[model samples]
Target: MARVLEVQGVSKRFLGLKALQGVTLHLEEGEILAVIGPNGAGKSTLLNVISGLLRPDAGRVLFLGRDVTPLPPEARTHLGLGRAFQIPTPLPELTVRENLLVGALFGRPGRSRKEAEAMVEAVLELTGLAAKAEAPAGELTLLEDKRLELARALATGPKVLLLDEVMAGLRPKEAQEAVDLVRRIRDAGVSVLFIEHLMPVVRALADRVVVLDYGEVIAEGPYEQVAREERVREAYLGRRA
Candidate 1:
């Protein structure tokens, strides 16, 4: 499969503390890749760098075979990069459909109102929010809020999507639903790269797993293989893999 995203020796720092150090990974076309690590392992930092929310002090980021290291979040979105935050930050005043419309209209440049509306409708259906299209975003349950976050990202018509711990607060059943939704999104041709702490969700959804510890990658492979690594076990001691 084609490489849709690449991070080469990426590094970041804050007041001499290394948030990320020589980190590297890639997301292949149509694949679901998971980044797992203990808290403060720089997983969110990696996502921020990829989405252009933060610039890396070193190395580069490439998207769709072009270097996007210098691009801002909006520019990256125009180039087929979509991002959903860990915390769902929907506009409280807007309905579900309206919230999605924000992404559709601005995600890419040169889109007409008609095109954006059509995209919003499709995303609402895709993310299982069609029935709640008119509901206020702030009034939805946690599951519904998550769906809206994912839906808003999809409305951008991305070729690659970055999801930051979308299942952090969900129950097991709700997380399963999210896992299925992510698979459907990948099947629809959007490659996914996500940061997740939920091991079950990672096991169920990831085609490949990258383990990060102390701001560096310690293991990268299929779920079963990575789960067996000693460093991964030590880093996540007493936690079932």
Candidate 2:
């Protein structure tokens, strides 16, 4: 299968700090890949670069076989890339439905209002936020907020979804629900690349896992295989001990 997203020899720096160095990874269509590492391992930076929040000091970002290294975030969205932030930041005054509508209407330029509205309905249903469609976004519970964040991203009709710790604040049950939703999303033909801290979530969701330490990939394989790696244990899992 062709890669849905690719990061080739990517590097980024902040003054004297090397946030990332020669990072390389790829996401295959309809697959779910997880990126795991210790804090400050450049997981977020990789997502930002892929989503166009920051351009790499070196390397290329390819989306669907096209070089999108120079494209802006909105431009990338139009080309079928979607991202959900770690923090769910919903528009305070807007209704849940409206929040998704904003993404549907503006995420892909030239989408008709009618088309966006239809998309909003579909997304709300998919994310299980249909019951709260008319509620104020700011009034939602943390679980709902996370759902809304994911729904808004889906509203963009992306071929690949970049998720940043969407399960962070949820309870075990809630996290399971989120996991199920993500599985359904992947089943519906979208590729996913996510940064996650919870090992259980990563194990349950990732088809493949990539471990990063000090800004570089240390291991890439099935969860059990990568989990048993000595370096992965030393750099990340052991710290949880």
Best by TM-score: 2
Model 1 C-alpha lDDT per residue in residues 1-241, reported as the tens digit of each score: 7999999999999878899999988999989999999988899999999999999999999999999999999999999999999999999899999999999999999999999999998888778899999999989998999889989999999999999999989999999989989999999989999999999999999999999988899999999999999999998874445
TM-scores for all predictions: 0.97, 0.98
lDDT of candidate 1?
Answer: 0.93
Off by over 4 Å in 2: 237-241
lDDT of 1 at 99: 93
Model 2 clash pairs are none
Candidate 2 structure quality by residue, lDDT tens digits, 1-241: 8899999999999899898999999999999999999999999999999999999999999999999999999999999999999988889899999999999998998999999999999898899999999999999998899899999999999999999999997899999999999999999899999999988999999999999888999999999999999999899656567
Flag clash pairs in model 1: none
